[model samples]
Target: MDIRKLDDRLSVAPQITPAEVTEAAALGFRAIICNRPDGEAPGQPTFEEIERAAKAAGLEARLIPVASGGLPPTQAVAEMARALDELPGPVLAFCRSGTRSTILWALAQAGRRPAAQIVAAAREAGYDIAPLAPLLETAA
Candidate 1:
């Protein structure tokens, strides 16, 4: 996994394998958040498979899947916020291209940080988040 650190407390990556969970644990990550829903594409490992590996590796695991291009559900954003608050850090969240992971994390950070900062962070991490401006305002 090519992990991209979003900040001190969070990192995001593209679809990760179960083996990567061990690497993540070894790297001192305390939790994993899966933003990709199950069966979203052919050949993708189910979240349960990853969760099991994460658990065995002694990492908390959460699945908060969000569809591409759709606005993140309010509940999903709140869940991510709760995860950030409750889960041990630093956390590693992943999805296809790592875009969804970054997007969800950005949404959770909405209002808590400047929208420009959030967008810049995502851009720095190789994601285009200029479109999330409206949602980012919710957190501003």
Candidate 2:
């Protein structure tokens, strides 16, 4: 897994496999958030499968699948916020390319930090977050 730290509490990774859960736990990630929709790519394990593995590894797991080009639902954002608030750090989230996960994480953190800072952080990490500006504005 190519994990990128978003903050002290959160990180993002490319798609991860079930076997990676143990390593993630070992790395001190207390929770796993899946931002990729199931069946987006052939041969990818379902979110439930990953969640089961994470749980077995003693890490909390949450699935808030985000469709590309779609705004994240309020309920999904709330769920992510709740996970961040409740789960111990560091929390690891993944998607096909990690873009969507980063987007959602940034949006969820909107009110907690300046919007430009968040966008700049994402950009420095190699994620283009221009599309989320509207949502971030609304979030603020």
Candidate 3:
């Protein structure tokens, strides 16, 4: 898996195959978050398939899908934050390009983290989270 660790508790990566779930477990991730809705792309694996794999690997899974580049709803952001807190440490979240996953993570941290901190973290992980600075400020 081409995983990018965004922080100690979270990582973001491109879509992962069900087969890769075992590998993720081997890498010490305790949970999986699928941000891409099923059928967003022609060949994208359904969340069910990935969930099955995650369960088999003894990892918890959550789905909070958002369309590509779509602004994450407040509820979804809240849910992401809850997942982060409820799930075990070192969770992995994925979308088609990993950008959406990173964005969602940023949104989840909005009020809890400074915009610069969140943006910089995402940037280091190869995602431009600067666009979210305004929203983060409002959230703060």
* Best-fitting candidate, scored by TM-score: 3
Q: What lDDT does each candidate get?
A: 0.91, 0.87, 0.92
Summing lDDT over every window of 10 consecutive residues in candidate 3, give the lowest-scoring window. 67-76
**TM-score of structure candidate 3:** 0.97
Q: What is the C-alpha lDDT profile of model 3 across 1-140, one tens digit per residue?
A: 88999999999999999999899999999999999999998988999999999999999999999887669887888889999999997899999989988988898898898989999999999988787899988888
Q: Please list the residue runs of candidate 1 whose C-alpha ends up more than 4 Å from where it truly belongs after superposition.
A: none
TM-score of each: 0.94, 0.90, 0.97
Q: Which is better, 1 or 3, measured by lDDT? A: 3
For model 2, state the Cα shift of residue 92 in Å: 0.3
lDDT score of model 2? 0.87
- Quote the lDDT for 134 in model 2: 70
lDDT per residue, candidate 2, 1-140, as tens digits? 79888888889999999999889998889999998899999999899899999989999998888887777788878888888898888999999988888888888898888888888888877898977777777778
Q: Give residue 56's error in model 2 in angstroms.
A: 2.2
Query: What's the number of clashes in each of the models?
Result: 3, 0, 0
Clashing pairs in 3: none
Candidate 1 lDDT tens digits, 95-117: 89888888888998988899989
